[model samples]
Target: MKPGLFVAGFILLFGHCTSSLVPKKLTDADGLVIRTGTSAGMCVGYCVFDYVLNGTNLTLTQRPNSVQSNLTTKTCQSTISQSDLNDLLGTVDLATFFKQPAVLGCPDCADGGAEYVELQLGEQKHRVTFQYGQTIPGSEALVDKLRTHRVALNECK
Candidate 1:
């Protein structure tokens, strides 16, 4: 066998075995709530975000700081497919997660956002709060993902 072919065959035969050796992902119930708040000028007080899923229904709401001197809240709702919901579930482990509060938050910094994250899986629930710019230990990846989801969910504007 040619050297390249030998190497290719070895990889093809063994590559599939590594997957089973990997640990199974932690799965949880199907609910998520992401509340984000920001503070800048007296004009822009805060921003709150919420996303909830029940079966095929997905509700997203964004209510910015009442600094506008207005009491109007914006909300958008959409129906999500089962496949999309499954994809969301595959993204994080609701179990053994959100056990610790985010670190280095509540700085007196100006023009920053705070995040209140809550996840529910079956009978399990975890909620954590931290500033957006601060580091969240043991959940940096999850925070980043939530930020991205925040942006995407923002399109409901």
Candidate 2:
């Protein structure tokens, strides 16, 4: 092979390989809460919730206004009952509790953006939003921590 052609091929291969290493941001809408950031890769799907914790028990209510779709302009409405919230709260730690925004991807739907979730906590009913994707390394560890917290709460009863 010609020296020039070999160099060109090497450059092309290097570019493709490096591109794969570059992380892409996953953005999604949670009703009025909108979050955007980069994730390790593309997201397949997600869910959003509004949660309130009382002692070791929690109530997670799905907010209809917190729905965002990347695949369709249409709005989606869903609810999470108080009993369901209690079950989820019992399983997770309320102090470290966080909500995830809905995520979707389709060629026919909108693409690109961060996923957001809004939560209302306590009697003050403080509202807060959380965005996922560009978090610290070890996504699994964070998830496990949350899961363990949930189990602890469940044991309280």
Best by TM-score: 1
Displacement of the residue 4 alpha carbon in candidate 1, Å: 62
> Could you report the Cα RMSD, in angstroms, for every candidate shown?
11.6, 17.6
* Candidate 2 local distance difference test against the native: 0.32
Residue ranges of candidate 1 with Cα displaced over 4 Å: 1-46, 54-56, 79-84, 102-104, 107-109, 155-157
**Whole-model lDDT per candidate:** 0.55, 0.32
> Candidate 1 on 1-157: residue-level lDDT in tens?
6999999988987877544333246332434433333333323533556666554465676565655646466678776566655565566554435457543566324546555566654454566666656645756666665565556666454
Q: Say which candidate scores most in lDDT.
A: 1
lDDT of candidate 2 over 36-141, digit per residue (tens): 1122123443332323233333433332222335532222223335454344334332233233222323221233323222223322121222233322222333
Query: What TM-score does candidate 1 get on C-alpha atoms?
Result: 0.57
**How does each model score on TM-score?**
0.57, 0.23
Worst ten in a row by lDDT for model 2: 26-35
